[model samples]
Target: MNPLKRLASQTAVYGVSSVLGRFLNYLLVPFLTYTFAPAEYGVVAEFYAYMGFLAVLLAFGLETGYFRFRAGGEWRPETVYGTVFSFLVLVNALCFLAFLLWSQPLAALLRHAEHPEYIGWCAAILALDSIGALAFARLRAEERAGYFATIKLIEIGANVGLTIFFIYVARQAHEADPGSLLGRLWDPDIGIGYVFIANLAASALKLLLLTPQFVSGLGAFDTGLFKRLIRYSLPMVVIGMAGIVNEMLDRAALKYLLPHDDATNMAQLGIYSACYKLSILMSLFIQAFRYAGEPFFFSYAKRHDAGRTYAVVLNWFVLCCVFLFLLVTLYIDVFQYFVGADYRSGLDVVPVLLLANLLLGVYVNLSIWYKLTDRTLMGAGVSLIGSAITIGLLFWWVPVHGYMGAAWAHLVCYGTMVVLSYALGRRYYPVPYDVWRVLGHIAFGIGLYLASRWLVTEQGWHWLVAGTVCMAAFLVVVGWEAWRLRRGASAIPGV
Candidate 1:
């Protein structure tokens, strides 16, 4: 089979889990928005933001490290997996112990002093998720997409189911009969805490389901291999953490930087986060692509024509992202209904955030250079610079312009990183990406979006019709370009 075809197939399988699972999980956004006030949902958002940071810390970039060494044939796959697994187990054990000893202080620091259990639940979720990170990476490396999709679906389904039971059935039952068993089991005041609990249960269940990987993949612990993996992954940890800050700092920063009271601040955050979900289509595609693309890129690295392959992949990725950007932005009138009516105030940020995520996806594709060339430190440096810009902008903007400012900050930060990464990648490990065509796609997509916005001045069916035409036109152009490229490549001797 063609390498790109194999990659597309694997991405489809991964998408079954990532895209479908996230679509299923998207249900939680509406449920949470409707069930709780924006402030309550903000608590959920903020907690998860912190989880994003902790998760990167706990995994310590070992998944990527495992992929690099294992794929490069530097060590036995089992030995690498075992080393990563054992190291995470030790780190998580220590983290859990520390959480136990200082849960109160930690809770206080997170502004959840009244509900310290939230901190503990988050710690457990992070630890379990970290331990399972290597296991999931192993499945990807082995091309066990079926098992991966199955486990991911189970976890997402369970999480959605549990959330409904807690928020709708059990909570309503308790509300109806405060003296009943359901009332004893459900606490109305727990409010958004149920979100965390549902995640905890689902993560624990996922870890349980992945026990076979833990058992079979664990081999003799080699301290030398462990040290080597750590050395390689340490910079990745920095990159991952900084990357998280770029992705999530806005959500987390809103709580502190906004001048409003805590409740008001959380309400703004909830609105921002809900609108952020409007970009789910772009995010899901990027995620699915990453899951398949990472291993695909690593494996392709050994090929004589890997650079051309990567360039093609990057072209398609940008094209897809641009299409998604138009799809969502043009039909945002309908997608806005995905969140609650109250959260709709922040709908304007959706396009900015979508474009930001698009840039981020491009940056992820460009990152192939650093990972393939073992200049992981350059990736870290790029991310740290991005993180600094993100933090500085959030502190400067969130206080003044609110979530809209944060959205722009996100766009600017990722956009800058994409440019920097491309420049550095060209200098260090050139991939001959079709730069002009990629930029043309982006410019054309934005042009169509802007045209639709200007032409479809009124809402209702007029907007929908305009959007559909714009989307179809964009697709037709892309299809034509793809055909042209294929013909052009065929004419070339070795393309």
Candidate 2:
């Protein structure tokens, strides 16, 4: 099979789990928003942002490291898996222990001193999630996308189901009859904490389902292989942590930087984070591609035409992203229903955040340079640059313009990172990436969206009609571009 097609097949399988699973999980946003006020939901948002940071730390970047060495076929797969998973088990255990021990102090620091269980529960959730990442990575390395997707969907399905039961079913039952058997599961004071409880249960169930892989990996541990993996993976930790800083720091910072009372600030944070769900489709696509793309990059790195393949892969990746961008932005009037009316206030950030995520996906493609070359230290350096910009902008912007500033901060950070990665990539490992054409795809996508907006607002065209017409035009443009690329022509050649 063509390599790109094979990768897409893998991505589609991963996407089935990631997109479908996260979409199912995302369905909770509206429910939660309606059930809890913005300030209440804000705590959920902040804790998840912290989870993003700790998750990268706990995984220790072994997912990519596992892929790199395993694809090289030098070491036994069992040995590689054992070395990575065993160490993760140790790391996550310690993390969960620390969170349990110092949950109060951490909760106090996070301004949630009243409910330290928030700290403990989120920590447990991240620990399980971090451990599951390597097991999932094992599936990818073995090309078990079907199994991977099945487990992911089952886990997410359980999470969504349990969440509803705890927050809705149990709550309603308790309200009707406090002495009912299921009523004990519903506690008014616990409120949004039930979401974390559901997540923790689901994560544990996922780990249980992967017990065969875990048990298989735990005993074959090799000291020498562990050293090799650590050496390669440590820099990945830095890169991953720094990447999380760029993607999530805004949420962590917004509450402090908003220059308002705690309640007002949290309300603002809740709205921003909830509206963030609108951009989840783009983020989910980037995530699914990462799950598939990283392995594909490493496995194909030694090919003579690898650069061309990377370029082609990126072109298609950006095309899909721009398509998603238009899909959401063009029909945002409809997509706004994904979040409750409370979150619709921050809807302006949706397009900005989507475009930022598109830029982030581009950076992900460019970042392959460092990973393939084993220059992850340099990759970390690039990410640190983005981290710095993100911090400075959050401090500088959020105090002034509020959540829109946070949105722009994401745009600027990713845009700079993309440029830096492309420059550094050309010097370290040049790829014939048609980045200009990729930008053209983005620019053209934006233009089509604008024209559609104009059609509805100025020309008085029906929105559905305008959206359909423009979407069809964008598809025709992409079709033309693909045909030209296939013909080895930048422009139409002689018939």
Candidate 3:
């Protein structure tokens, strides 16, 4: 099989679970938005955003460390797995204990003191997810995409089923008839608390499904080797923490930057979060790309012409991202139904955030340079710098401009990181990337987007016509470039 095709097959399998799973999970957004008020759903959004960051901490970047060491090839797979498994078990146990002890205080800090169970539920979810990190990492290392997909799909399916049972079927039944299914499970006083319970149940389901992988990895505990792996994975604690903080600090900041009223602030945050769901498509693509790209990068690092291959991969990434951005922006008129009517007011952030994510996807691709070169510290430095910029902008701009400021902050921060990574990459591990052609594609995409934006505003098929034209232009350019590269016509010398 062609290498790219093989990679695509793996990506599609993973995407089945990752992309479709996320899409299914996103089904909750509309469901929750309509079921609960925007402010109520906003609580779910904020808590889960924090969960995303916490999952990073609990996993501590061990997945990346797994890929690196697995590629290093100095030990048996069992030894590597054993080492990682033992350490993570100990660490996650400690974390769970800490969270259990501190859940009430943490909830108080987040101003959810009356609902301390929310913190406990999220903490449990994080711990479970962290424990499964090695199992998931093992699947990726072994290229067991099919198994990985199956496990993830099952987990997502279970979550969706339970959520529906809790939120839709149960709640509606209780409302319509007191003797219905929801009445049995419903506690009217708990209100939206069942949302967290459903999530907790689903997480425990993931733990059960992961049990086999966990057992298989622990043939014997290699204390010495475990210590070595810990040393290597420990730095990731800082890096992952910093990276997650970068992603979630905005939410933290936004809470304060907005008014003191919980209802008002959460309403705005709800809008922002729902608009963020619009960009989840981009996030899905970036995630699937990372799954495929990370292993591909490590496996092919020793290839004589890997640098050229990296350039090719990056160019293709830019092209695909631009295509996704255009498609989403153009058809957003229809996609707004994903959120509730009240939330559509924030739809303007969709385009800005999508573009920012496109830039971020590029940054993710470019960042592999540092990883492959074993200059992971460079990544830490770059992310820290980007986080600083994002935090500064969040404080400086969010209060004045509201959600729009958050959108621009994401764009500026991600854009700066992309440029910074490119600059530093050139110095340490220069690849002949096609800077001009990539920039041209971006510029062309911006122009086409602007034109479509203007032309689509009129009545009767204007959007359809404008969108079709823009899409065709994008595909034609991509096709032409693909052909040129295949023919070895180096229009941009190094490219």
Candidate 4:
């Protein structure tokens, strides 16, 4: 099989799980948005941002390290897994212990004084997910795409089902009649905290399902390999954490930076976060690509035409993201039905976010150079540069423009990272990426979206008709490019 085709196949399998999971989780969006006010959902959003930040810490970059060292083939797979797994357990255990000891202070500090259980649940979810990260990474390393997809689907399915049960079945029932059996099980005091509880349950269930990997690595720990893994992977922690800073700092800053009172600010965040879900498709595809791309980049790095292959992969990636961008922006009204009317006010930010996610996906692809060349420190540097932009602009803009400012912060931050990563990628491990073509696709997508909006708003065309015309035009352009690229294709198996 063609290597690009093989990577695509792996990415498709990963996408099945990720895209489907996002779709399933989207069910929760309507459910939560319709049921609770934006202020309520904002709490869930903030806690998740916190979880993302902490998860980067707990994983300690070991997944990438495992892929790196394990690719050397000097260590047995079991021993490598054992080394990573044992280290994760130690890290997660200590972190969870700290959460348990001071969850009260932590909750109070975060202004959730009455619900320290939220902090504890968040900590546990982070721990379980960090370990599960390695288990899934192992599956990717072994090319166990079927197993990987299956477990992801199962975990997401469990989460969706439990959320429906807790929020729809029990809570609603209790609201109507508080003296019943299901009502007795429901706790109004917990309120939106059920979101955390459902996640905790889902994480626990997922860890339980991954018991095979957890149990298999128990006897093979190697102190020497472990230390080396730490040294190599620690920079990745900086990379990962800095990446989170670029990604989540906007949300974090929004809470404190907004000039409104807490409820109003939280309400604004809830609206922003809900609309952020509109970019879920773009983000999910990027995630699926990362899952497959990481191992593929490492394993294929030494091949003669590897650089061309990587370049072509980025081309396809940009086109896919462009299509998604147009798909969402051109037909945003249809997508708006996914959230409640109250949340609709912030839908304007979705296009900005979708474009930002496209740039983030590009950076994800460009990151291959750094990871492949063991220049992760440089990667961290690039990410911190983006983080600084994110912080500065977020502070400057969020208070004035509110959530739109955050949306622009994301766009600027990711756009800068893509440029920096590409520049650094050239200096370190040069790939012949089709830079002009990639930029053209993005420009074309955005232009089409703007044209479609004009048709709908200015010329008074029906939105559905305008969206259809715009989408068809974009598809025609993409198809032509695809055919032309194939006709001129000269990226053979070897130099």
Across residues 3-120, which tens digit of lDDT does each residue of candidate 3 receive? Answer: 5556667877877678889988889888877777777777877887788787877786777877887788876777778777777788888888898899899999988888888887
Segments of candidate 4 deviating more than 4 angstroms: 488-491
Which digits, one per residue and each the tens of the lDDT, describe model 1 over residues 83-150?
Answer: 88888999998998888778899888878888888878888989998998788999999999999999
Q: Which whole-number lDDT from 0 to 100 does residue 440 have in model 3? A: 87
Candidate 4, residues 121-175: lDDT per residue as tens digits?
9999999999999999989999999999898888888888988898888987898
Q: How close is candidate 2 to the true structure, as a TM-score?
A: 0.96
Where does candidate 4 clash, by residue pair?
A: none
lDDT of 2 by residue, 384-491 (tens): 999999999999999999999999999999999999999999999999888789889999999998999899999999999999999999999999988766554222
Please tell me which model should have the higher lDDT, number 1 or number 2: 2
Query: Global lDDT for candidate 3?
Result: 0.80
Candidate 1's C-alpha runs over 4 A off are 458-461, 488-495
TM-score of each: 0.97, 0.96, 0.94, 0.98
Give the range of the ten consecutive residues with the poorest summed lDDT in model 4. 486-495
In model 2, which range of ten residues has the least summed lDDT? 486-495
Error of 3 at 198 (Å): 1.9
- Tell me the lDDT of model 1 at 456: 78
